[model samples]
Target: METSHPGTGDLATRATEILRELTGRSDAAFRDGQFEAIEALVKDRKRVLVVQRTGWGKSAVYFVAARLIREGFGGGAGPTLIISPLLALMRDQVAAAERAGVHAATINSANATEWDEVLGALRDGNLDVLLISPERLTNPRFSEQVLHPLLTGGVGMIVVDEAHCISDWGHDFRPDYRRIGALLASLSGDLPVLATTATANSRVVDDVAAQLGSDTTVIRGPLSRDSLRLGVAPTSSPGHRIGWLVQHLGDFSGSGIIYCLTVSAAEDTTRALKDAGWDVAAYTGRTDAEDRARLEQALKDNALKALVATSALGMGFDKPDLGFVVHLGAPSSAVAYYQQVGRAGRATDSADVLLLPGTEDAEIWEYFATASMPEEADARAVLAALADSPAPLSVPALEPLVGIKRTKLTLLLKTLQVDGAVDRAGTGFVATGAGWAYDAARYAAVAEAREREAAAMLEYEAGHVCRMRFLAEALDDPTAHDCGRCDVCAGQWWDSSVDAAAESGARKILSGIGVPVEPRGQWPGGMEKVGVALKGKIPAGERVEEGRVIARFTDLGAGQTLRGFLAESAEDAPVPKNIADWCITVLSEWDWVERPTVVVGMPSATRPVTTADLASGLARVGRMVDAGNLQLTRDPGSPEVNSAFRVKNLDGAFRATAETAAAVDGQVVLLVDTEIGSRWAMTVAGRALRLAGARAVLPFALALRG
Candidate 1:
């Protein structure tokens, strides 16, 4: 005998009940368009695109729909597969699923040990939902070993969280998300697919919808967050911005985020805030995974005042009562600004959103905007090298062959892999033997679109128009209207005045410079391939001791002055009195084991005067012997390159002068330079000094560039 199923109306009613249970609110009904999206997925079995504001309950739609489908609402469908962008997002969704009585598991980079168990649960039909990062979809191990079997078994529905990332035109375009289109194509026609994003303009929406299917249903709600009060706090300098944050951060009611554009900026701000007695932590891409988890928890629990962070903290960090979101520098695009600010006022009646635009923001934006684009020459070089290799080539192995930097090379490989031109095999990358064509037109279009978005961001900072409405229009929100709570709409709500004492304190911190210059412990891999005998770790006796620099090339204080002085157009000249004084201050603060008895200068083809003057000034101040400059065996023209290539280029580039070698024997030497780029010059020169009988060498530079 066949069993009868419940009616469509009954299933819809059950979804409401599930929502209430999940939210723990008896009156938790689906928001205006939420039920419609759920119904489309559960009953109609159609692909859906949901463009809603944050805190508008998009996750609820998918979780409830997954439960309804698994309960036989759509022919007793299999488990739902959610493609999440961030690990934090996945954790929150998994917890939400459990509260709704849905068995959920996640396979991500953070939980390698749990992957097998998660896969087993999925294979046994013991899970109602499975979440995985978008990047995991492209991993060969997962694609061939796990994903194939899961797809064969059939997934009831697929959800793409932060769907804007799928579109190249989106502000946060991620190459990994391109795999989602292929995944969608491989699924059955009737498999319900849902893509959700809080930030998407019409262009991104059309792009994502086309990726989903031509007949996909898009349900876009108003982008306005009435609870958010937007404002821009324009400051004359970075110090002023820091002062304002120091003075006003505590006035906010709850924990929040302070977003910075660069990792260094985030670290500097965190340190300054902490020194001022604020409980804060720095969160960036370089933060360890374990630390990231702990910091995320601290922020969620309100243990810290704010997480001074980069974009790494964006996307899917849930804090229901987050009091504010402040940007130390403006994002390059209004779409990104909206997405980050959306993190606030979610589950609260009101929250503050402020922008503190910096002068260097544009420079930083320009660097990042063009860094990830696939250059035709670089792509062709990568492909040619891979084709020549009989076996898979590791990144280190391919670095010298392609002559492209590691970071850019990795991004290029990922783009090619997603385009079916490459594959990852075991420990290395192999060409797929598939014919690939470079999409030059597409990349050019993306570049142009980015330029436009950057311009839009500048306009946003101008604050000439209603801030909320401007963002809404940028996202193509049809209901764009003046959000009366914004500074432009109703006047500024935040105090822009900086405290005098705070400004003085911040100026002191920014001006007092000396960043540690950690020596490279190991030689770059694959140096043997380049005819260099060096490999593995550097010998301790020959290695340069921990050094110091005046500041990073991107620093806010003396860095600005150094950048101006060291510009390509600037003439080589003696060190300025102020910079020389600062150098002396740094040396005085140094806690070296041995005081330098001599100062030796590194040979600089471009800035010889600057280097020689720096050496003489330091020697005079410390009353040490002024050793002559190291002679350059060969002039390696300044070439923009990575570590392996840099090391290869600088081989035999410098030699210790006879006078310097004899004078520095059995004495501590300070190796000084105008600026350090790649640090290969210092490494090579320091080794020469050590080989010449110097007891120890401490590398010093005005600026350090990685």
Candidate 2:
């Protein structure tokens, strides 16, 4: 039952006062639907879902509700709990809470040392708001020790920020977010809950609302941004796109973001832009947390012209005055594209939004879109292995037995843990033997939905209909109407013209190639379990020296050429003369500790001619003795399996020829291959050569797959 508090009639006045204090503006007032949401939570004690556009003051409603409830507006409720998705979002919310005098604290991975302090504050009832990542809900310690007690004791309010992630129908579905449903179920009936997101379509809306409750009050506002001028510019190639950005990034006003499809693309674009005198930086998952914070601050302070980043910088970045957002390639779905572009024109009168569609966008999308779903066979293997284990099996220990990559394995385990089929013990993951059933139907439906979204994205790029209207309809926005500001409606506001000089410079930069191939410093986990007799740091004597590759398979430069050569349908042929020349150039430019006196080829079951030609060409040009191919005692087939299985498969597969061993005795040896997929081949072959008395092995490959 809803509880009535004193001065319920004055909630609007009090909320407005709090809003003014939070905004530091005397005239601050609630926008349309904002006061209604605040009143629903504070006075009516009702659950609410607010699907307002970004910069529409969604945070204001929750912050005001928390303050009112703490001040006995909701009959003396407990402190509010917020399940935020990102550390960045938590930091912003905590700061905003402080400004509003809400006394907020956070528990997340980045601030582990402060967790105790935050917990103390929570116990003391000194915090009005507590923000945490959704992943924390699944942590054994956090759930049993903290969350359970908080739920039992009573929370005044629960907020799921970026609530779209809670639904599989959402564009950015995170597995950890599935735990929110359980958290909601544990709460008392009278407690208020709020779920907020800007990107959810009608399907996602229904899914999230069902998770919230049957009585959830959803308030969805217009999805269109009036200040955004959208446009799509089709590029002929990756180089042309880079050239376009170099030429026209300055044309947009103020600081902005240039989105790339992959981390390699982000780095390449950053380098090319910097070389052409653009002040920019690359942001991706590979960036360290400290560096990420620093770069984010730089962008906020307008210290950089733009941050060329992948999806790592997509959500929860609050830059109200961000002037523009440009996509180097289209995202797989209009929902995702709209969310990214929403960051712009938020607190500005106008911001330019441009999409430079690339020729390889679909290929990149296919690579990432299907990576998260767990295969039935892999899931069953994990369950059977765990069921047979005497104790919890860590991911490494299970890797060899299951034959799944570590990254994919971890994701699968998390899914199972959430499904109640697995539990995390001190040692590792233990099977609960709960008779877990694979939801093949659900997974298949999700996959089909993704394909449909991909097709819709292609249609959006084609621009047959109004871009804004297309996106609005895809989002199931009821107020779908053509915005007169986009390129289609406004007759091409963006110039598709390219600068010749910039194009030439970009082509030259892309052509200049050499990617460092860092040697594997340690054997993958579970190699010992696979009977490989290896664990921990690789012996220095058996390790290959730092090496170089012609380019990454994801590179914008020679990547297309390399991809065609390595295509499954392409016949195995000798290494092309241009690639051979590039290989020679890479060797000449190498700053090695010692010059290689002999070159050895890695035996390839599929591309023996290409591998042999590369080794012989390098040996001839570098004037090094040709050590010939390392004899394959037993073919490992292809290095397409996980690390543990790959190492196991390659064990005792190669032996250095007697002549090759003698030729390389006490001398540096160069190891050449047409391509490096898992790098296991080079590592195993290098170990063989090192054991055969080669002083050192330097690995070189035509291309490195990211």
**Candidate with maximal lDDT:** 1
Write candidate 1's Cα lDDT for 1-706 as tens digits.
Answer: 1222546458768889889989999988888899999988988899999999888899999999998888778775689989998877887899999998889988876565466678888888888999989988889889877778778877888999999999999999989999899889877778899999999999999999999998899999998888899999774577889988898898787999999998778877886798799999888875544457678999999999999999998888898889899999999999999999999988899998889999888888887877778888998899999899999898767877877756678888989999999998866889988999989899999999999999999899888889998999998888888888888989978777788999888877676798766575667655776677877788987789988888876776788788778765579999998888889889998889999999999888779999988999899989999988988888765444445556777878878878888998999999999887656678878988888999999999998653
Tens-digit lDDT string for candidate 2 (244-352): 8898888999999999888778877887898789999888865534456778889999999999998888778899999999999999999999999999999899999
Clashes of each: 0, 0
Flag regions of model 1 displaced more than 4 Å.
1-9, 499-501, 504-706
Model 2, residue pairs in steric clash: none
Candidate models: Cα lDDT each: 0.85, 0.84
How far out, in Å, is residue 507 in model 1?
Answer: 4.6
lDDT of 1 at 672: 95
**TM-score for every candidate vs. truth?**
0.75, 0.75
**For every candidate, C-alpha RMSD to the true structure in Å:** 9.6, 9.5
Pairs with steric clashes in candidate 1:
none
